[model samples]
Target: MDSSAKPILVTGGTGYVGGRLIPRLLAGGHRVRALARSPERLHCRPWGGHARLEIAAGDALDRDAFVRAARGCGAAYYLIHSMNAHKGRFADADRRAADNMVAAARQNHLSRIIYLGGLGQQNHEALSHHLKSRHEVERILQAGPAPVTNLRAAMILGSGSASFEMLRYLVDRLPVMITPRWVRTPCQPIAIGNVLDYLQGCLGVDQTVGQTFDIGGPDILTYRDLIHMYAREAGLRQRLIIPVPVLTPWLSAKWVHLVTPVPASIAQPLAEGLSIPVVCRDHRIRNLVPVTIMDARQTIRNALARIRQEQVDTCWFDGGGSLPPEWTTCGDADYAGGTVLGGAHRIVLEGDARLVWSTVRTIGGKNGWYFAQSLWRLRGLLDRMVGGPGLRRGRRHPSDLRVGDGLDFWRVIALDPPKRLLLLAEMKTPGDALLEFMISPQGTDKVELKMISRFLPRGLAGILYWYALLPTHRWLFEGMLRAVARKTGLPVTHGPEKAAMTSALECRL
Candidate 1:
């Protein structure tokens, strides 16, 4: 069978790299099957409905599911990693996932497996656990009967990438900083475009199969160099950075966690990996797959431009369990299941539903949360202190939002323009939560807008957490409703009445 005719299976199709790569593959006339744990996340992608692209809902760790997704695929891109796993079990999770993929590939007789791995010396005693896990996954894939093409890369710089976001927030938020010695360590960073080109190029070049290549940008520099370059690109004043030997990687990770949207779980491994020099040792892949490699300065410049334009295609926070809570969709008695606590506030305004929705969708990000922005910031700060993605993961676009896009700390689980927008809370909480806004026609020139907050408590703490904030939540919701009406240039015709909890259940449909 012709390779081009067979579909290419992408394991992390909902991830930062995989999300961007799938579109390229489709554009290149290759059939793509994107394997995602939560297929709904992929459904919101721009290319989700492409005729040549298929979404496989499955987990890589599940061998049977992996095999099912791999069947009939000419090759597979093994871009899965478990860096966001709870505690330090990411290594074990990654190992198990790789083993599952290997078995699946062997069973399905896959032609090749292309893996993107971190760049680091295997024998380096100071190698971080993150890079070690990546190296281990590479070995496991290569050990399979199917040929493996491994592309090892250092930091990837682009809009919405984890590394770029960390660097961006740190430099933007801090004018003067205390830094770790790793800031001076030499490193080679690659632009996301170059990385994608190399990834797709390998599929055409048969020589790339069964070979390992080190991929990097044109220039090699230190973290300090990246910081200053980022500031220069963003038009910020020169940053003052002080390198200190006393700060360990763990401490550095904690600092990054507080300063940036990247959590400590993901930041720690990255910080540790930066401690080791990561310059490319081999450039054989460069000759096999020629691409105009971008330097760090140009890459940073491009990223800032994208951010300003609000045109980020995919974000580092894109990958995660974004499935709506089962109770959210279940149509049962409000108290039938576990305790679900919620309050709904509705406002009758004299305007078209479209006008109200236009204002509603613009909530969050730099536009602010309408009312009590300082309170929102305080909540975000508290959430960040607990290792959650605060409000830093802003909305992808200013006025438009699709399902699965990150809006501040909330993920858009459901979006129906000019009608309904439901957001699932990503902030640290005692239990699962959802914030939804619904717009409905009230009368001739009137629209009713409802803001609902629901929480399915975990236990006693969850109950306490809800009641304690009951007063504040009411004020916030009512104020936000009035503010939205004002912003829409619509006069409030009636009450900002407190609706029954049962009204929250109406969102199930």
Candidate 2:
């Protein structure tokens, strides 16, 4: 690695693979230039705001954006595709995106392009739309001037990845699942961490530069085996998986959508794609990248650990309202009695705890809460009329907030510097309302943030207020995180709708 060479451009820096890859690139002593249509959506991401990372505000499909981002970079990582777009046009969109990246790389004189494509090959008669598109993208990229390094991977079992989460939700929620017969289809999955290792190792591997490698973990297992493996590790019962051949991919997808948060578009195509075997046919890259690959069981455990921690790396919602609220804890907790109704995201941002706290405290004042302003005001007014602080009085400062500052209808009852802030609702409706924000340094520069919103309903009013506002609250919190990522310029690869978004890998069948 030449220190004097220009930085690397990572398109889809906000995506699943890209999210994990950015950190590696930075850690490898390479400067990172990330392309995103909305860089703000990444503030909550792990690589969001490192000094080594330069976010290039642009979309992959935008020719100008792509050209500008790729200019002078030693290498470019292409990790994006759209299988969730308008009906029947996903492949076209993928081709166009590929064309854009190729043209940009050519015009910008990029040294190399590394792309992670789907692993399994298919006969033309049996190929699915999603896989075809993936293959097409690879071909398009290879035809360009830059030497394209394409790593074909199966399911990536990690936090926020689609195949991993879909399996996780199915296993966690159901003791028995009516799975399609495709459960027996063989596939290989790589741990997220191992995949990152391979990606980082490729940066200087000249032999891998112009090659296509099948990347997977050490073991090959049927989807059923994966379910059992995850179940045993999770300490759950071996799920009674009723595999029926009659259930078409479309029907199976519908089943997944109704039962899990995965959208129908992602599920259906994924279900159809499942009929094919996804086992890795080669181990050439592993020899070169040389990572200690995690087994399927371990991969599932790691994924569950992250999901339970609520630091999911992708969005799993079907294209609709914002993603649902999910949470993960760090090192400590006892469940207290209260109606818990808000989504919590636990992130380890690299900064002093105090700095992170100051950033949070300044939120929700003159700068406004990240999500819904009208909704917040309406709720604040209702609180104010009921003898609450309401929206009448704002916070003391837009940037400098104290522990006891009055923030609209909310009061800062408890404030622990660089560690915690507790807010007690001055509103009159609920029996008692509490919002606690806690931040602790994971390391010298990493801060772990936990926000807990607890409300004890008094009677009818509280219940009505909570239920009526539940839908909006879900969207708001989810979007608020995105807004936070955007505002703070955080580096996140994937998120809330991770499962849904990644579901396209399945549709390629």
Candidate 3:
């Protein structure tokens, strides 16, 4: 089969693996179709505008929509999983999703379904829910009329992978740590590049169809070894790790939540899965797809290199909020009427919308929040003192913003260039907060800039916190808007002119 000639379907196109895979597939001369719940979200991807790529918007659980996306595609990649789902619900959701995909593939007469699952030696009864769910998903995919190629892998060492990010933050933040006994479990991990190679190499290979492969790297190491290796590569001092047998996975997950950028929901399952050994039992994949797998030290070095170059392609947070599965569906709503307090400011600028947006994307880190640099630094210091992320993370690229990219103490939740940018607060706070900027064209020569800061307080403490900072936010945000206008080298419109500009901006959007 000439695989590149037929259109291929890629589900979970907005995720870490899927996002990177699309570009590789495209570069290999394959026509691709991505099935996204909201196709507009895929716009944030680097290859969003590729000529050979088609985006089909629909939910995976909807059989009809899944079938529509699979229509006319030769092969499909199932990279979807509910990492943020509740403990009791994720497995069921995974099963249903796989079943839906199977029905779609059978209905559309697709050649095969390619799935990426977990690597583990434990049987169904011994596996953790997370790993068991992965195995179940693979079985469900194959139960259909189409042949399924399942690739099972353990921790994928890469710059922006979830496992890598968790390790990065934990190792960087803690000098002396208390860990669970499962940290000593043996496992064979794989590098993301090698994993991608196998996925691409399997495309038209007859041996890969309806086959299950255990893929791993050259080195076999424990979680403790992985962390120590990361510290050595990053030039950090040796960390003192004390392991205790009593710390349950739930408790370990909560500890992970407090220390890393990953949330409790996703961390819990990961922590649980650490108890099982995920080593590859055989090297059969080498015969069909030959690729050099790097050792742990080399993998860490490669991941660090990407970070230093500010070239992290996709992060685990790209799909949206870390806490809830439903948060990804909250699109463009700036208002939270009930308990959320909001501070908003709008200004009219006599410059191109593109210039104004360029200014917006470049705020924070060395650029220093555009205005009130001292106040911002002071706040960062206070946050760091309290064990918060502060503003130290800076950003990957000064002028580029992608979903899930870290900017100082905030994470980019949404980015629509020359139009909108939404950031979620990742600092130690009593409540959830979002800072948003919306830029709309006001005729050909002007633009309207709306900056809104919103806080959803947790309780009395959160309520008190919002009101206490209201005055500071008002002053800072108002001045920031003016600074942005200044960056465009444009004059700010006055009272009457502001109204006219607003009218034009409203019409354009």
Candidate 4:
């Protein structure tokens, strides 16, 4: 197949890399067919509406579904991984997925398969499960009838890359950290731009087929060096690091889980791989691809620039299947009734419901939370310390709220103007949460504003967490509702005055 003909199939369409890669492919004038397990999730992408893009909904493990997605493609990109899939036997699952992909590619008469794997020079037997799974997937793709262009890379520096996010949170949150031995491990990290360039350059490139290239940045640095450089770039003070040998991969993962937005399960494999040095050994791709590689410092600076502008195109959280299987049903919260646990507050205000709704839309982002800006900032900082999105991902637009839009760390799940607005918590939490605001007209010149905070706790910890924050919730939620009322030109009252206002509002109802 030639570059100009046939659609390029992308398997992990909603993933961190694939989500960003599709836009680049579309801009390069190539038709893209993206295969996803949940097509509805793809609709949330900024490039989901591109005319040249086609989205195929199906799981890669389903042979028939996989073949259908790959049928009209000349080449396919196997970007899917099962590491964070929550399935205990991820390696076996990955093997099955790769086998299915190979069969689909062969059945569909595809020309080539391009894959992005991990960078490691260690023997396969000595490599960590994560890196080994990547290598195993590469080998499986190579065994197929079609030639495979495999690009192996280490830590990818970007605003939304998982590795970058983990580093970003660690450096930002900790001043003195007791790190694992891997902190001193030397590695060659690559920028996401360079990685994308390599992936795109391989397409229909004769020299790249049937070849494997090790990709990295212009300079090599230790993991400690990376943290220091990131701190300097972020204008933070030098962070003190004490490397300890006793922190096993499990303990390190738990540490990372507590400090960053990455869950323990996902962080475990990543933390384990850090023990192996990942410097790139091959420079052949640079000669063939004709792309400039940014050094470590420059890459970190670029990622910071993107973060400051809030122009992050995609994030590690964009991947759909990372959440637990039970949490998946939380999407049905819009249809689900009642608050399992949380606070409910209501205020009757003298204003148009539209104006009140408008005020609600501007609650987050640059407008800041209405009642207490510092408190919200503190909450965001604490969330960031615990590996959450914090307040960085602000609203997509200042005055617009839509389903699936990320407002700070909250995702808009239900948006009904002048009536109801619902948000699902995307921050790291012990329980699933849903925050909803409703504005209803009591009569002319009177509107009832209701705020409901709900949480479906996971276990004893989740229940304890809810009750522990009950006092804070009462203070914050009550104040927030009153603040909203004040913003809508309503009168504020307390104690007996509040009781009088409530009676008056009740009469209007």
Best by lDDT: 1
- Candidate lDDT scores, in order, read 0.88, 0.68, 0.80, 0.79
Model number with the top TM-score: 1
For model 2, residues 1-509, the per-residue Cα lDDT tens digits are 44236888888776667766788788778889888765644443546678888888776668888888877777888888764622568887788889999899889788888898886665646667788788889989999999999888777777656676577778889998877888998888788888788878888777898998888888888889988998898899889988876887777776665555454567666766667887777788877878787888777777777756655544332111211112112222322343444435455565566656666777765677767888887877565444344564455346544333456556554455557666656556555656666666675656566555555566778878777756665466556656665666645344433111111111100
Which segments of model 1 are wrong by more than 4 Å? 329-337, 503-509
Q: Which window of ten consecutive residues has the lowest lDDT sum in model 4? A: 500-509
Q: What is the lDDT of candidate 1?
A: 0.88
| Better-scoring candidate (TM-score), 1 or 2 | 1
* Cα-based lDDT at residue 175, candidate 2: 94
Report the Cα lDDT for residue 76, model 4: 86
Query: Relative to the unseen true structure, what is the C-alpha lDDT of residue 75 in candidate 3, on a scale of 0 to 100?
Result: 91
Ranking by lDDT: 1, 3, 4, 2
- C-alpha lDDT of candidate 3 relative to the true structure: 0.80
Candidate 3 regions exceeding 4 Å error are 1-4, 85-88, 122-126, 322-343, 347-355, 364-397, 403-416, 422-435, 439-448, 453-473, 482-509
Decide which is better by TM-score, 2 or 3: 3
Candidate order (TM-score): 1, 3, 4, 2
